[model samples]
Target: MKRIQSGTLRALSNKEEYFETTDLQRSIRQGYASLLSGEIEMPTPFDMGALIGPILNEGTESEFRAELTRRIRRFIHNRHPPLNVDVETVERHLIRRLLRTRKGQTTLSGIGVESSGSSQDWLQGIAPWRAVRDAQKEHSSVLASLGDNTRADIPKNILSHSMASVCGTLSLVPSADISELRSALGPVRTVSERHTQRIVKYLHEHTDWVHKHKSLLGREAPRSILRQRYRAVGMTLLAIWPLKEAIRKWMEDNPTTHLRYAMGQIVRSGQYPSAINDTLARISLIGSGTDGRSAPAGPSGLVTWWQHSA
Candidate 1:
């Protein structure tokens, strides 16, 4: 390989610089290039391979990154006035996911074996990948029943059943990480209804609840969850810094996005405390130590917390 000069090296996007750099970036870049060159058609049913096939030949994961990218790219090209796709945000999500599996493991396919094998065999060989594959299968079926369109309107009964199915499949995975929860819950985002968005929020809260009580539940807390907690704790150092006025201004200027999304932007924007510590603490206490009110059990408790908190 030709030697590349350190002085000449630079990040392709802003978010790329923040994440731990990975060789997978090259493959992802290649995939996008192939799409732009019309070398391949975007896959329907949104197979994982179509997006990452430049590196891995196959996968069965049901994560949204691939499909979301496809939609954003098409929007950019097809919009009459042109759309400004947030390539950095897309790349961040992709990199975080691709970097999850060990660097050299063949499991980087983002799902287990390309072909189906006996469930027992999969469970014995690669439980993590098997769990992801199964959860995706569940999520996919639910989305397909809704016409497989992100913008489709969803009914309450179908939505509830879909949530149950996805979360139930997820519960099968032992000590699932945030990425796995993300994979299981991602399809809900496909339907652009507020109900679906609320579903996503509830799932996040479920994850938070599980993570907080992992010891009692006989599971390990996901690293991402720990990081959020630690980040909240770390923000105390900047408590003395004056940021309330600036944040208020930010909220006023950006009124349309979800508060969580906007806070994430503020936190990642720079060296200021974004007041997410309170939110994290609230999520951490979702299912336990309540104010003498009986909330529904399990994931429904998560939904109840979201409703009450909102």
Candidate 2:
């Protein structure tokens, strides 16, 4: 590579910034389902791939970083606006997951592969991945059931079962670290580690793809509050230091567009906002910690705390 300098270097470094799934996508398919445990979800069957990434940490005896990256890249670009999987994104997922595994955190799929010294409630609370098994079966059934246009179909218990299985099986409760956690959980039968994580790999390959299905498969999918709660998150990135002049000029020039899409949005663009200046001024006037939160108000905005508020 030829030597590049200044702004070019900055742009290159900023190329693969963090991409959160919640922030992407504007439209959603209204229906889909699978026949998991006799319940159907709706349009197309529910694809668990969105909730869970395309790859699972299948406890394979393989070395960590290298194998993980290779598998991840394969999955992200499986469809639609394929994921540009970068080392940073991979590291973000890996580090967070590794920490969670070591710390015994809960996963979306209620399958906790944790062990609290082999306690009754702790281990019993966890369930095996039955959903994944079902998905494998439905994949066969649905293909046989439908033809070209499958726009209308209740989602069969297809991806849900398989994802549940893969997620549940691959997830390990948090211990000291990855290796220690693995050791505590026992031997490294990575391949036979309760169904090797091919499902995750598959999901990765087909990210953002809405599989077409028959009209008859339509049933009830996520709706109302649950749907709203899990709605796609839209983030507004702001520039650093916020020159606030050129943008102001642009807004003045093109008033209609800027007012709706840009203003009052979350300023996650690595910059301080003009709106919070007063809040900072007041904090400084009172000399910090008035809210009983913490010190250093510049970077402190919203801190979500979960406790016994009841």
Candidate 3:
């Protein structure tokens, strides 16, 4: 029989006592729920293969415990984004499992497995499993909302559930589709109906503009430029929604070849002359011309001008 050292015996006793405490018990419950629900990831177990050398050599109990702790800590640090569990919580579970196996009270089968049951059994009940089921239900609901292109059925705090997990699920969506945009923007809980409607209208207008001036803008006009232009217009409209009808009427009456130029003309002629300059400044397009000149008199300049003028 392998004789247990006094230090190892005492540490094991203390650990067993600690596990019985309410605080540790509650933490274990919460941690297990989080892990099983995929809110916090379970790290891969440390490679115990290396411990064979020292164990065969009859290393001291304290030395073995120290080595195990060191290896587990190293394993956690090497994780791609690092383990999210509390260090104390992880250490407690790891040390307890190690103690159980060393005393022959448990048997090791593989990573996260033991003869007594799986390492997950340490969580003590079915609560964690139920938490996982709830998480799956929530995830399915969010996916359904994305598929339907509507936020009416989505949970209010769904975005706050787990950003990384939510984003990973959304990554499966095709970027070219409107569903992708809806999914990305649906998480913005503060977005209002007026803002959404205005954004939809702006997108329609921009699409029409693109189709009309495909030759002028060039077929290869960078998608980034188009996105920036859209954002600029959207932000301007947000600031000037009360005046949107007037702006729309003005745009229809005096149609220029390009959207930006028309905006600049409006700014130059509108009651709020300084607004054009302000919007341009806000969007970092003010004075963006060769030789340190103010914005040019073309599409780019006009877009900036309109943003401020509106």
Indicate which candidate wins on TM-score. 3
Residues 33-127, candidate 2: write the lDDT tens digits: 23333255432434233432334433333434456677664544342232344322332344345434535653233433222222111112211
Ranking by TM-score: 3, 1, 2
User: How many clashing pairs in candidate 3?
Assistant: 7
lDDT of 1 at 212: 23
Model 2, position 280: C-alpha lDDT score: 39
Per-residue lDDT tens digits of candidate 3, residues 86-159?
Answer: 43233234333433443454333463221332222221232211222333345445445454434443333212
- After superposition of all CA atoms, the RMSD between model 1 and the true structure is 23.3
TM-score: model 2 vs. ground truth: 0.17
> How well does each candidate superpose onto the true structure, as a TM-score?
0.18, 0.17, 0.21
Which lDDT values do the candidates have, in the order given? 0.34, 0.28, 0.34
Off by over 4 Å in 2: 1-133, 141-167, 173-188, 192-199, 206-310
**Model 1: per-residue Cα lDDT over 39-124, one tens digit each:** 88866544333322233322222333565566666654342321344432343344334334313233124432132112122122
TM-score, candidate number 3: 0.21
RMSD of 3: 26.5
Backbone clash count, each prediction separately: 1, 42, 7
Q: Residue 176 deviation, candidate 2, in Å?
A: 16
**Colliding pairs, model 3:** 260-302, 260-303, 275-308, 275-309, 276-308, 276-309, 279-308
